[model samples]
Target: MKIFKYLILLVSLSVVMTGCEKEFLDTEPASSISAEQVAETPAANEALVNGIYANLRTYGVGGTTAHTDYGHRGITAGLDNMSNDVVLNNFNWYIFFYNYTGRVQTSSRASLIWNTYYSVVADANIVINGLGTLENRTAEEDALFGQALALKSFALFNLVRIYSPSYIGNESAPGVPVPDRLTFDGKGRGTVQDVYNQIIPDLEQAVTLLEGFNRSSKQQIDQSVAQGLLAEVYLETGNWAEAASAANAARTGYGLMTGEEYVNDGFDNIGNQEWMWGADIDSESSTVYASFFSHYDSFLGGYAGALDGYKLIDANLYSMIPETDARKDVFVEAGNEFGFPPLSNTKFVDATSSFEGDYLYMRSAEMYLIEAEALVRAGQVDAGIDVLVELVSSRDSGYERPALTGQALLDEIYLQRRIELWGEGFAWFDLKRLSKPLDRTYEGSNHRDFGKFMFPAGSNEFLFQIPEDELNSNDNIGAGDQNPS
Candidate 1:
């Protein structure tokens, strides 16, 4: 059996790990396999692909052992904390994010987001470069190659959005560098347009290559997942028709969870039919204290439960949820049986109560929302509303198809997105894409007192400054390249 070494990021592979401030080192980075050990056979290729997925859930990928640094979920938790919708009671793990300090150039959170995504890009580049060409490749080989492209595209998409300004008016703005497997040299930042140009084509090719490929797990990217990713890219780039089409295509087979399913099964299961993509965390894979459940699951004796680190829906947002809505039940009300805070969430309880709650990365509900939003934005308001009604009706039996039109209807869709996807990490990015301000200081605000400051649309505070380490290490990004603090 052929086996390739599982290489973590080498200084040569990713910009993040490239050693020293003054001059780039030729020395091997900590925990890396040499180029010579990289194999090209199917079995070896499969192992490399598995490693890419593992990085999505692996702890300490951000070069920190901080409990808040556990892979993608950690990033999501931070992002949600930055939004007004999710409120944290205490200043323990995500205080920086809540107070808008995490995006500062010097913060570890900034470095964590930059390093982790770039590392994924670096690893994906290795798989892509190893595979070489698509012509005459076997079915297994094509799928592997496509997955690598999709992963790279996914990583770059996140990086560009995090570091650069929104796509619409800021296409010419500085974006993250697009490095490939063989690009050993340091590279300059691409424009936002340049990054999306790479992202769109890569996802398009992935959509084609992954056709008819059946993944063994939801964690693996397949044709629909790639389509879903493409839909998101299109939506961000303001390609409304393409976004709607792709989103509609992406949700073809997945069904929404019924009210019972939503209320009974805590939103911690990867096996949920609505969950199109998620991490299937178990005893072995679970990070225990550093896991998503620890922070988010209020009933599971984790941080939120035992340490008073409870997260709650913003009072303003919570008030919008109808009493009849099943989604409202997830947030523990006043005089609840649990004796927790009035709005402490019971939405994310670990079914095992063992800190093994599965992480939701992507789901069909997001696609339906994306399709509806894109359709409405594209002037297909009725079609978009139809999609919205189908999704909302599943969660709220009393949901009435609104007679709202124009911005009112679009606002309703946005409200549904907030209600539906609140904790799964879309809030801050959604604010950025929509050019909306962070408004947490309303009359009935539940935001942490320190986090009450509001910023206008397109505030520099919304941007995560390129980390100082990257500026010092990568010759391309400099003091001038940093986003305004």
Candidate 2:
């Protein structure tokens, strides 16, 4: 039920006349290029693709100037706060997420998530449907078309996961509406299967279309990224073999960072050896205080550093790391000089301590873990163990391959994933996909008392409620179509 209000505003601004001369005011703006013309020009099509990527990092896409309403990363940080691994020292920015109110139908977080991703979907559709038929597409057109399809799939995948139940057993559950065209008319909530039917095919086509397209920068989606995304979708659907194959294919050329690189180098660079996909944030495009590092990086001069917004790791999870593990160095120990929480994270610091810290969306390390997990789940325990060993050995020199098999080995990979990807925003989705509960009430837990919530597997709290605005505005989604409170 999210409207294209921002799109209308953007288009309106494009044609606004700025000069005072009568001739200038009367002349047609270059922005008034027809859709057919745009479709026929490769550069124009590329520019449109660039706009879609720009919106991913742009501030205020959630229809508000609220500090917590930045684009994709905003929703990601909120998801991590909802998980058990992250502990906020004090409630200032993402308090609703920590206290479990953000997912409610009436909360701003619900609307923010719904509005932002749907806007991406709608924009991608403009590029996708605008292109002419498949027979005579140029190489550049194929690449541009592939990027649009990949972006659409990425947005829809996140939407379906956030708004509905996990895909394994709830295929028939109602999911967010899938709008294939640029229209204002309300669309009904479709089945979970219906959304995936669109996502899977889109990703597959994106991979094929992007086959030989080498991107000049990491901000753009290429074939490997598309394949990695497909591996994730396959993993969630329990297609273990397919997941393993696609993950292996995706991580072929990317190597794991050495332990020194993992520890000393601030994780704010897209050029890092392990990084496969990330935002290339710079001064001109920086969102200043409304950025990922502002709320998460303790060394920055923004919220986390200046206002006691220290993002801490759960004490129990911190305790699980051995002294030999390099990953443990990222979190501070108790009685630190800064007077922050015992395990406040230093993993996401900016070396320059500026607002231009880059945001990492995916890395080669994730592909290895996914490949390992899928292999183990598919009963290739020995191959899975080897993959897991290769990854963990890079982080912990003293570590030897555990003699475990089956569930024990699988559990170890899960632990590694938790340690490696802590604040990069996979926590809540991981918990939901594995059908695990959010249990923060354990003894010696560092989770704040007010946020020590316990929700069992398959609880209604795991799913975000469809925002009230959607219900009131979309005639197709009535009271009966709403998710249970």
Candidate 3:
């Protein structure tokens, strides 16, 4: 709560609320101004919305920490390492995340994840709450309002997914706090069902408000982005029919990138046609050594390369990828032995030698998979297979419509998702929602600790504990509220 209060003060004082600058969010700290005294014009209001987008890039989630990316990049890397798809070569940085050893109630990563997201949520709440005070609203104002709502919903959804149990049957389980107003007091955690209930309405409002609003940048939220988020939320809650409809709607104007495009492109550019939403990091805004490319890009002599390539693709997963699939070449087949796994992932690399590379948040391929899975879950097995065919054939020309039904079809979809998404960050979330076991005790597993690697289904490690800072500072949240250590 203290952290939240401090951030609110900084935001209120730093951001200029009067005349709008094209890169208003990029400006350094200036004279303090009251929120009520600014944003009177559409341009100023637009600048306020732009502040949300800027926060999405450089706020708690995107900032650099010591040896780690520590933003969305860090979260994704941690989640990938937690799963069996990614293997760490050394017990160096991120070893705690890979091994799940120090993910306690007071862990730094847990604190960063929690604080960063709520900071975004708090900013979004200010924009959303302050919108009603102005007079003669235009379409521009409505668009900004919708974007703020969607951003808030996105942050809340992420927080709940990490801190609470799966929503399948544990809807009543304790979830992260839902702070709708711009207040400093700790609101305390809500039930998983309560958070989802709040999230659904925000997304619904976002979809309606964003209709026909052509966003100038991929960083901004639009109708498609809102629908995509809603589809994901619906899928998580097991609303199969609604999930399918929303997923299909979300893929309206987007198409899957060709296999060649996927392999050749660095997967770092925000301008890719397949990318739905992303952060366009440039040299000016790059975190240098602590950037996404520095960690994940194997070609760069950064963290991944310095340790003789720590971010490796699991051998089991690498073997499953068909030789015919171009994606199979994404990792080193065999050659260098860094005293660990040989199949290191080379899927991500910077466009240049510099550490600057755009970060991807969402893509169209995920929508197709979402639609396919939702269709199968809704009892439309054949329809699901057809949708899967469209996505799979695009990636692997040799792939044919297989003679499979029921769980087999679902399994194939899951496998395709694993291969397609890979380090783009869906593995741990999928494992959580599907209640899958994490068995890293295989003979050739690259996990540093065998004892902590094999997490069974429904393990307590699935939920991250609430940070100790929040527990000690927030009156409503205490030690009893923490997730199992």
Candidate 4:
């Protein structure tokens, strides 16, 4: 059954020729064909690209768990557990991630993340490389080619971020191998700078190519998506001005959601104007136990809130949210109706009790936060504060722009970011980039295991080891090349 499922996914990768309607890529192909053979026509090429998006939600890489809707939710859960913001109240599937145990060079989760992303990258390369074979290229073809590049860049961007050290003074550090084409030959690790160099240009080209192309659905990548990704890349590389500019470019057509909309709605709808990129999980196509809601949703999830285990928001951070802030209501306070732990999150729930909920990949609010952070880092303190005030005031009607500067102002902005983007998967990355220590020893902390409570800044546990399979199979990477255990 597993092999049959994989075969179906592989065949579907080349069979995306449905029609004008923007729907999920759930159509099974009549037969299998090589990716190169699949991109012969414009429709075929477009389908191939669409399949990449579909592959994100289906069984592969992060999607190994049955019915787990393994794409963004799987990645998000793992990433969030690695940080201090979200805590596991009981031993669950993600307990290893929460404790940073079993994340060794050979761990299955690490391997899944590595392999699944590379699979996307490999298919994307086929589409990108095959674009030149077309006889008469149109804007659509250019857009397809552009989307392929952007997707490829996105996969590589996340891979490098997870597998390598921060680019800050760590440019020379060993990073994941930069694969430009689909091949089995082993390639050695490159420097962290090498991967960034590749990612930046690919996204820049994608932004240019996708300029006038109309997308069938929000699931598809557009100019704004490329720009948003570029902004994040710039922020990671410490290119403050470019990050701010790219963020503003990405925010052109989107606006922040009203406080009422945020609190009342379960955040399962991708149609919300605040969402920039997302996976629209149709009810019929829902992956029951494997879906995002099954894991993250308080009322609907299998592991969180009123379920087998609980997902708790960091108590210290929760205390920082002012009562005036509407976002504070997203989490259930201790002694609330749910009987959940203090600061247990209720931010995500399926509209019905079912596990069918759209998974958000990126949002406009992230862009606003990125712009603010970039501006502040670039020495435009007041301008940055103004941007933040604009966002915060919307969530907290009584918010008065606090008088803050220097590190204090930066800290405040970071705090707002944590509150605004919690569970959306920024916590771990932020902690790593800021070189912050993980200390879960505070009062009311949910992390009870002493052995896993604190890891200092620059600890070996910060980066995931290259999968043991890769080290064993690839000649370029060996045991010595593994991240510190």
State the number of backbone clashes in model 2: 0
The Cα local distance difference test for each model comes to 0.82, 0.82, 0.77, 0.78
lDDT for each residue of candidate 2 in 1-485, tens digit (9 for 90 to 100):
55643454236224222211232123344375556655576655566666666667777777667788867887898899999899988876888988888888999888888888877777677667767354689888999899989898999999999989999999999987988565645789889999999999999999999999999788889999999999999998899999999999998889898777898878889898888787777776678788889999888888888989889999888999999999999999889886667899988888766788887888888999999999999999889888888998999888898899867787788899999899888989999998889999998888888899799998998889999988888788898988878
RMSD of each: 6.1, 4.1, 2.9, 3.4
In order of appearance, the predictions have TM-scores of 0.93, 0.94, 0.93, 0.92
The alpha-carbon deviation from the true structure for residue 407 of candidate 4, after best TM-score superposition, in angstroms, is: 1.3
Clashes of each: 0, 0, 1, 4
- Model 1 scores worst on lDDT over the 10 consecutive residues at 18-27
User: Sorted by lDDT, highest first, which candidate order results?
Assistant: 2, 1, 4, 3
lDDT of 3 by residue, 64-160 (tens): 3645534566677677778878887776566767877546776777777776677668777767767755676689888888888898899888889
Worst ten in a row by lDDT for model 2: 15-24
lDDT of 4 at 319: 84
Off by over 4 Å in 4: 1-22, 25-39, 66-69, 132-136, 182-184, 450-452
Query: Model 1: per-residue lDDT, tens digit, 1-485?
Result: 00011234343244333312212122333345444433346655565566667677778778777788878888988899998789998876888888988898889898888778877777777768777654578899889889989998998898888888899999999888887557545567879999998999999999998999999888789999999999999999999999999999999999889877887888889888888887778776788888888999888777888888899999898999998899998898789898888788878889999988889989999999999999999999889989999999999989999899888988899999999997998998899998989998888787878888789999988889988877777777678877888
Candidate 3's C-alpha runs over 4 A off are: 9-32, 38-41, 59-64, 133-136, 336-341, 450-452
Q: How does candidate 4 score on lDDT?
A: 0.78
Task: Write the residue-wise lDDT of candidate 4 on 255-352 in tens digits.
Answer: 88888877877888888889999877775556677667777787874656445566778878888999989999998876898667767778887886
